[model samples]
Target: MANGVLRPGAVFAGYRIERVLGVGGMGTVYLAAHPRLPRQIALKLLHQNLTSDDYVRSRFELEAEHAARLEHPNVVAVEDRGRDGGQLWIAMRYVAGIDAEKLLSEGPLEPARAVYIITETAEALDYAHELGVLHRDVKPANILLERRGSNRRERVLLADFGIAKALEETTQLTSSGMMVASLPYAAPEAFDNLDPDPRMDVYALGCTLFRLLTGRQPYPGSTLPQLWYGHAQAPIPQPSAVRDGLPVGFDDVILRALAKKPNDRFRSCGELADAAVAALTPVSQLVVPPEPEPQAAPAPEEPTTVEVRTRPVATTPPPSPKERDARLAIASVTTRLSAVQTRAERLEPAFASLKSEFSAQCSADLISNERISSAEIVEAETILTSAVEALDRGDAERALELTRAVRAHLSTAERNVDAVTGRLALLRAVRANPKAKVAEVRFKVHDAQMLALNHGTADQWQAEFDAQLERIDRIAAELSGRHPDYWAYITGLDDVKSHISALVQRMKRERRLR
Candidate 1:
């Protein structure tokens, strides 16, 4: 009924379409049963309109073909790609269970569960990277959680390689000048039209992890432009900062993965995966703590005017060797605590320096006039400096701490830059015209008049205003692209459009638009 339902027995490439599972801008996914294998597979068909565009068709096929070549257990395996009845489709192993987004939306996953999913995904990405495939879109929606049985743990399967780009290889699909990915999860480099790489996947993965822990995307807004600005300017908050009970080490690994610069991130997905695994392990288990002796009770206070004379009591026999060994263990624990304190004191300055440099770079970038500030480059340098200091002092804990701090700073700097750039663009548009003021007054009058006519019900009026605002905003965006100078001259035009669009849509759904 939705255009994807092939008749009950419709067969595509020897598989029968059971039903349509989902549909997107480019195609439809169907649950199909294999003719002889007795297996169910997800079959994706390119939309009819999309196939009319040769570029989209080729890209769709390329993605399927390339993804089919990857054989990792964690990566969803593509079984076949072909056309039937003028419908091009791809068949992949059908994974049963909800996507990561749906699962997280229901509730926060246990920390261990989150770590498990992330680690599995990292391994899958690492494998793809080794094969030279970059999953340009690596958001939570693309990660599927497959639960086979009631007692078995869920398996993480990375899906939707539809936008995956083979590194260093040029394809007709991308050459045709079409944006092939979702903007929300796109890496900063992708925005600059740079070649796709594994680090892009790394940034996306970090964003997904942040969203899972926070119950919201790192940046959320009503509009795409707003979301983009948030991504570009908001700092990555530590998981522990937002949710209580999360381990500090868990925060460190997330921050590291989110490092603005690719070089600053873990050298590879493998490294990141390993770090995640390590973070999930209890620190007490990894590092043995010295055993401390039970504290002795304090002596009772003597009353005033007590007799000064003291009676000698019989002395007990000396402790056995076992007792002596026990005492030695207590001493050892004391020595270990002292050593820990001493090391912490010595490493304090190095850590402080790392933090200072990271902060300074962030500040400079936020205030600078560069078209594109290399926050990643700055972050990478900080990470390297911290790594060197850590190695020099042979303190892994200190090094890890420094790495996390730099990562947090980097995430914040990148977001800030985006926000500032978007706002600056808006401001510039506002300053260019006198008529923009007149347009604002006219729009406000129209809004007020409509409100009065609707019996002063602000909701009804607000709905109308939102629709107009969306239209104006779209027009202004287009104008900004063509006439940057004229954007500032048209005040209230965009705002009016956005507000009106929102209101109208709401009213229409409520049957009040008539």
Candidate 2:
């Protein structure tokens, strides 16, 4: 239990507290160790004052729920959440990298690297939007830049999932009922307190991009209120104006993002990212050896009809043996890479289909039926999403490998559900046999086990389990004097005892599930 303070070595919600990471107006985050796992996690808990407010408590819990639902390569992953000893906490995957706000303190990032970060972040935002989770807080502090090993790739992630929207709804924050976004990044519509829009995220992303490239805000007012008028009426600044060597074309991407009207901004974060990348580095500059221009027919060779073979045309001799081999090698490598990319593109739809399958599977009550856990499905979905991101990043080979893994995972989950279906059918048959040793033995145990694993045994389910147990015991007593026969193999007293004991044990264990 935490008493307005969590000391080192204290345990909260099954995590061993280590040290405080940071404190904010909302709450404090601590570096904590998993009780059963061998990894550390970031434990974010609401402060006591905030916890006392119903809206704040709901917002904190909603943040955990919505953020946990999103599992993308470029989004921070929330591991778990629950209330503990009157304290609400969210456990998240801990990253060892610094946030963009701190990184920019050194200086503006490389132009290429900055674009990469923005692209990845935009991708993450787009994914969350598809999941119906909006990340309203898009700022430098919320974007973390991680290093991708020797490749030196910048792995950017968007954090704080839906906290901003949750905050926006709080009466404490918006007394006038007008919406408030982070001043520097807030879209014009955001100031009008309009309904939440995805374009708001785009607007903030544009501001973050501005800082990433120029190391300064597009509208550098001193305070949130001071920046409001500028956001609504100020001229959009050009990235080129802030930094040297930037193309005037770059202004197109930034100004459109900072557009005063939400409708006038990029329709989606992906569009914004694509436009920025294109403006910064055109495609013509990337594809080299430009497609060979079609050659005109050599002026018909002056209409020469005479016998002129010309020594086999003296055709450039195939460039020399060494040159031919080198060209062959290069061509072969290019062909292989292209093939991999094609295959990746083909498998992308398969991943999307898997997502639909997962959604339908969960909604169909697989977790309630005890066939598989929600965590299992979430893990599969996460892998599929990561594969999509890999494909987007042009890592075709890796994406293809992950797609295969996702296929295998979904297959295993389907098989598990099928097996459970068969078991459930057999149990149903046994439970329906009124003349047997038990009228409700197998089926009742299955129901109890499922309930215990899921929402636990409520008074209603507990009563049901008890009534079924009583009915079974009465039937067993009634069959005590019967002669031993082949029926012993069907709903026998021993079988009844076995299932009863197992269900009881599960019921006890599930008391600690949350």
Candidate 3:
């Protein structure tokens, strides 16, 4: 444990260590095997000395808790975690992939491929935000891409949430006199330590997209202050400016994403992805053809007045039953779509309230969730616009279908907003009386653990333990971050954590006996 590196073949905490996967400021990640299972995992061990620091330990644990809560296909899943000797360790899926930072050595990625990677990463960020988590540190090093296979689409995942924070959490885990987010990718607000928000991630991701597209950082500075100044004060750099033949539209997307004010940026990572996709449309397709010059009016021809005889209006035949039914269906769908739009409008107040409160409190995670709702509303509006266009074109069936889809999107958006507000209410209630909330959450964690242990096989119990840990961790973090004042809550979490360690140890012992 001298340098937090495990020698190959060394067995620790039931994992047979193979070799170092990577090394970083926090610790070293090793490719290791499960003690009783024939599978490998990426095990990360915090540097021994840092583990003794309360802040570092809390941040490391928070990373595991945050990443574990994000059940996203584009996000790395933390499978297990515990302390060994004096170092805290976590086990995660061992992705046979290369980090995006390293991949740059082969030169810039193809524009389409880079956008695809960013889209995937955006999905992971959006999912994390929906669950009230923030990947405070998003950079090329943390963006992982699986080794390519001829028959498979490339897989990209966002990893290393060591600096992540839960929604409305007050602890400044990202700040300990060390730059948690790499300087080049760090947002402007980060330098000022302004309350972190989802826009920070947006800014970082924008920088990342620039890197992948141009094979260089958006702002290259020779020193820390220079980089800080660039992000904080310099004009946003355009990807097209750095790389020849790059789409000009990318410039617009990056400029907005890396805007000086968060308000000027995309509301969520998904929106940024959507814009990036739009940028991929061919310039010719996006351009509007110029109007032809009006032909000169024909020289005044004699106005031959035709007789204006008014004949009796011809009676049109009554509509067929099928036509009448289609008209009725369109009316019904239109009414439903109107109702959906009204519902979304009504929910706007609550959503706005929660967003304002969280933003003022520097709760980036909740703000991001609010943005998710906002994005959903935007999407519903877009669909509604299309529905209107269909109606204009006399496509009643298409219009009806689009209306129904709009309703569904609005419903989903409302549900997401409701969820965010519900979580906010619960967190507020818990903060009202931390002592009592701690006891309640603690009892639940303990009860859940015992129930799992008493009723399942080792593997089942392990799975149960992980599920419960994520549930209770969210409660605990929302109630109070790993603040020293919340020692009781931390201790309760430790008890719940013990269940997993016990199961792992028992499994190893039983395997040896067999």
Candidate 4:
């Protein structure tokens, strides 16, 4: 279907094409197997009609270069690229599973599975954002699910970069009057031709999560224009309203992410992922959600003490009206001061508890690691301090407002901690195991190398890591190290390290480790 040639078993670039996997609007994807290596790959070739256009060829090359730089478990890996005769082709990892849209069509996934997919995708998006790449078109169709092994279910891999925009690039792929279309997953700003950002990806992710839970797109319409209108004017319906047995906080998280204004949405994909995880967790296990307003019952209608002091009243009234007004003002100020002191007394313990929690949750490595910076911690602390001050001033309403901000910041900090801590623990385990198999050791070493590069300064860290990684490559070059097809797992680590090296360099310069 690609070119009315290159059929199954046909050789292209020394790889035999097995069959056509699928045809998209812009290209045809084929299932290809390498001749010498016992591995299968998906080769995507640009449509023949567009090969002659220099603009299309440039955009295709740009996509391959950008996609090749991304190396995350949740992202589909772009392996190699070349021109096959008149057609341009990109070799990508061939995943034997369905895309997310197809998986959703059968029914809603288990709640835990859905959360896992969403969280993993969020991490991938966070990494991409740090490299200044925005996957402007994020939807179920663009997400591929890869099966690992027997009983391993499937892993989510984000795909499609046809419309992705690189923040550093001045040229755009889409024409001036053309509209870049995605399904219901497009954010409000996406429709307005605004440059996409991390928040825009967060908004699309929210829409995707909503669809996963409810088995329906949030804003379904007959036409793209109709959907755009709905996105602009319609309120996001609660998840529970569409389906029963939804989690309590699910609706709120989705609504917040789908906020009309970019500023109203979560600041980053990590924030959205953290909130989604918390929502999916059982209510009994979660810290209770904060109560915004707590009005005290009308203090039992305190009895009025009406002691009739007739002589005192007459003496006071004899004074000038101006003197009486001044006295009233003084009394008001005294009462306000008393209230402030009382509030301070009540909030002292709460402030202490908050500080203790912050210190206990954020470790030194978390603070120093590139994943979560000191600026985020300072922002959270500042907001929490303001909340305490507000409470001390008897402004409970304003205090509650600041508390919400504090909670959002804390959520992001917790996620960054979790991500970095998990990676650190894995590395430590690998380092401690003297009897670790070569495959396992290689995997750990590769991960460690990536972490080092990602957290390193922008000067020569990449070059240093590259030199160290070459040792692994040299080991694979030995004749005695060759192994059977089944034992070829060790070589896979080399491939992973090569890709991750590129990813680390891209991310470190952009400051998007999280």
**Best by TM-score, which number?**
3
Best by lDDT: 3
Which residue pairs of candidate 2 clash?
179-193
Q: Which has the higher lDDT value, candidate number 1 or candidate number 4?
A: 4
- Model 3 C-alpha RMSD vs. true structure (Å) is 17.1
Please write out the lDDT profile of model 3 over residues 155-245, one tens digit for every residue. 9989876443321122222332334447788788776655455778998899899999999988878567788789888988878668877
For model 4, give the 10-residue run with minimal summed lDDT: 168-177
lDDT of 1 by residue, 431-498 (tens): 44433544543444353434334333565465555565555555555554543434333434545544
Q: For candidate 4, write residues 53-169 as lDDT tens digits.
A: 443455556656766778888888888887766778888888889888888979877667777888888988987765545687777877888878898867888886533442112
Q: Give the TM-score of candidate 3.
A: 0.57
Which stretches in model 3 have alpha-carbon errors above 4 Å? 1-4, 164-181, 288-514
lDDT of 2 by residue, 1-514 (tens): 4456789999888899999987765578899999999999889886665455554555566556757778899988999887776677788888777889899999998878888889999999987765546687799888887766876776788877865654543444543223233667777776665555578899999999899998998887755567777888778887876897664446657866887877566667887787677666543343222222444434334546685443322322234343322222222222323322333343334333323532233223333423242334455567756755664454656655664465344434433443334333333343354343242244335434444444434663566566656756665555445432223334455456565656555554565464
lDDT of 1 at 239: 73
Taken over the whole model, the C-alpha lDDT of each candidate is 0.58, 0.62, 0.66, 0.60
Could you give the candidate ranking by lDDT, starting with the highest? 3, 2, 4, 1
Q: Which residue runs does candidate 2 get wrong by more than 4 Å?
A: 1-5, 171-181, 282-514
Clashes of each: 32, 1, 0, 0
- Check candidate 4 and list the clashing pairs: none
TM-score, cand. 2 vs. native:
0.53
The local lDDT score (0 to 100) that residue 457 gets in candidate 2 is 47
